[model samples]
Target: MPLKPGANPYKILHLEKGCTDKEIQKAYRAQCLKWHPDKNLDNKEEAERRFIEAKEAFDFLYDKEKREEYDNREERIRMAQEHHSKRMAEADGKRKKLIEDLEKREKEFSNGGKRSADGSTPMTAAQQAKKKKTDQRNFKEEIEAIRRQLEKEVNEEVKQKATLMKTEREKHQKSQEKLTPRLLLKWKTSEGLDYSEDDIRKLFSTFGIISHISSAIEKKDRRKRILEFESGANAWGAELETGNAPMPEITCEWLQPPVETVKKASDEPVKSTNTGANNLEHMSLDDLEAQIMGGF
Candidate 1:
């Protein structure tokens, strides 16, 4: 006989039904190792067939929709079998009762007992209706059982797929977090000097792409500009080549951001006891003299 739905896959993988995804994967690997055509030189054809069967089974069970459908079909087949068995039992019981009634009628006729005018016993209308109702109820119950089993299997498959997807997404996100653009070169200029952004870009553009050029020239601070290259190689090349260039006033180095230090709050407040300095404008001439004397 041909294998039923959801039956051959588990057998092919050498696993019990309802095994976890991890177990399925492990079994697949083991099957591949054992039945690989390269390893079975003497029986290449058989090994190749087994390997293909294992792969197909794994593929079917690995997919949620295909697995669920298989499970539902299996459940329906089980329900049908149970219903058939019940029907066979009912038919057998009816046959035995009819045989007993026939034997009893034969004994009565031999004993000269009076028979009914019709001379045959038939099912009453109520009994016939009751039997029909019972059969309908049994059929409905079997269908409902199959439906519930299918639903449960579907829900479990969905949950498993969701968990697998979540794990894969988290792994992808972590890999993305590990990758970032390379750092750019930052050069600090000497105080009391002037350097334009255009001049900086032109100076570094020969080596590689200049992503950004920024200059900060103010009254107190001299010109400080940053040249950001597209890649680290270009930045290193610019650093090595520009060392002997004419521009000696400015220094070129990799710029790193300053680290921030967090200060903890103190419980006690600091006290200042310079009342003379606090009220210097309001102090009188004698007070000023006394303050000056105290300081001496």
Candidate 2:
């Protein structure tokens, strides 16, 4: 008759039967922000718990009939509680009457006016020994019960400690493995020289370039560009030491100009025929072309 949960569940959310749909929805959202599955992915138990709470709230609020049923059930539970409380009070009164009767008997015995069936005090040694033995057995049984309970608790505690130590050992081993040395760089034919991925990227960054240095073997075009850039850079560095300008670099694009632009400028030589000769239409790089046309 009495309503009682054997243990506390420590729920993340609680909803009452009388709660409005809007109120329930608001509570669900507020709880999900902190206890959603995605938010607690690392804790499978916690994630499942929150998921279950959210689902329960949704199930109760989504259907009108189900909600009405839940309300009825809660009312029944409240009535049952009230009845149980009344029953407990009645039982307590009866128990008090029984205990009073027992006390009345105990007091009559303690008045020390009892006599044996033979109308004389008799020393029954065998009966007294048997009673003492029975008392000892009962005491021993109580001690054994306590010992078994202590043993069960000790075993459970040991298991918990073992599990925690295992987790800690795994974590420690992972850290040790990560600390071990790594081969950060290795030679690849297309890359030309051995350098770590970070170091190669650093070289690209130094030249104000933000390109990805992909696997040179898998990506041939990236490999060629890297080699060409490195080669040209090395050559220019050499000429700079001798106090002389670097050699002119060549490209396929420079050898061919846009025919339409060249034709447009060449045909419309309206003013400054010489100025039109060195127009951007005939050059790949305006700055380099300007320098060349200036005098050198």
Candidate 3:
């Protein structure tokens, strides 16, 4: 039986699209064997219909021109379907994007552009609190580090200053130690009376033990005199007490010894008082015997 126009011959024969002519023939033979009227006497009518459909499919596919036309038509229909599906997919994608955009805007509007509309923060309250605590801890650590650095610097500066002061003090004390307990005195009396060295010495003698007193022999420096004390403390005391002077013109000042004199004094060697008998005590027995033999 002839197939109706637009009927899919490949479907009737259970053949795949783009099947070769040999494959179509093989499919038709197999259908005929399965649905022959003689092979199915009890279901002859249905078998005959199936058999006729298969025969019509074979006839249509056997004609190369008709088969090419059908294939072309099918290809055209398939292309149209694919084009429609592509358009539909594109439209769906656009629709989805528009919906997403609308939802985003709506969500933003609902939350005043800050968060989602569900009144939910991106992080939980506990998480936010923990982050805040971590940040605070880091800030404190930085501050503590800075404070420690500053304190260390300050302590180092103070220590350096103290060390410097100690060194300066030691140097001053050494310099002071080199000075003798002596004071230089000069007087311009208000009464225009000449004060002898003895008189000046007698007046300052009340402060401490006076070692000696001498008047300056220089004619131009006739008012100048030297007063030596037994001790530095006495010399300083006398200087302090006589700072105002008996008549405001008798000034006393500490006398600094010359550096060369002090160095010379320090470099002087001690004289040994060891006699021959005194040396004998320190002499080795061999050396004493050798000395006695050498003298003989």
Candidate 4:
């Protein structure tokens, strides 16, 4: 079976949860040495099992992606536990109320001689009291059964929600991983001002090889530019350096594209153009101007 959130990898490795990666590695190595089958010749089978368990724990904790998944699972488990606890408390309160009501009914019956609602005695008071007691017992039993069933359903729902959340998170992570390297460069320029293709190239040349530069469609007034880099690393580097010092007279910062934008970009068919300048030409002047002024 797959390891669930309740199964602590750290426990298997004999380390505390949230331990440093270095600590985990150290513990794993020690366990491997201690449980090596060759060293435990008298109990090779037990030693092998322990060794595999330790190795599996280490593998799950070592990977960044898997570790995140495990953390989410643990969080979901905690939430479910909290929900169960609260529901149980409510059930206990209801049980107490039912007991109180039964006692009150018994007092009323004693005072009123257990008469029927029509004001005529149905049986002797003792017989009527016994019947009431039986009814109360049956009611309590049914309530208990319902509470148990509700608890079971709630637990199942929580588990299902957790599974769904994990699946969606994995899907989102995959989509983010597949996102192309792109950077939005916001710049400010006076009205009617424009930068030539060569000039723009010269300005961003220090950053990285530019894949494409287009006016920001969203910020026409600001003369913002979206510069796509051949690599994300280069874009990140440029963003960092630009923040430290102004890129010439122009001020700019990097903007992360929205998920929708990234998805759209990923889906759009790539077109071949003869020249980099032609890429800008194919776009309307208004659109190009908007892209340029878009960044600040």
Please count the clashing residue pairs in each candidate, in the order shown: 0, 0, 0, 17
lDDT of 2: 0.40
Q: What is the C-alpha RMSD of each candidate to the true structure, in Å?
A: 27.1, 26.9, 57.7, 18.3
State which candidate has the highest TM-score.
4
Q: What's each prediction's TM-score?
A: 0.35, 0.31, 0.37, 0.44
lDDT of 4: 0.59
For candidate 2, which ten residues in a row score worst on lDDT?
1-10
**Which candidate do you rate higher for lDDT, 2 or 3?**
3
Question: Per-residue error at 59 for model 4, in Å?
Answer: 2.1
**Cα-based lDDT for every prediction:** 0.52, 0.40, 0.57, 0.59
Q: What's model 1's overall lDDT?
A: 0.52
Off by over 4 Å in 2: 1-12, 105-296
Model 2: clashing residue pairs? none
Model 3 accuracy (lDDT, Cα): 0.57
Deviation (Å) of 111 in candidate 3:
2.2
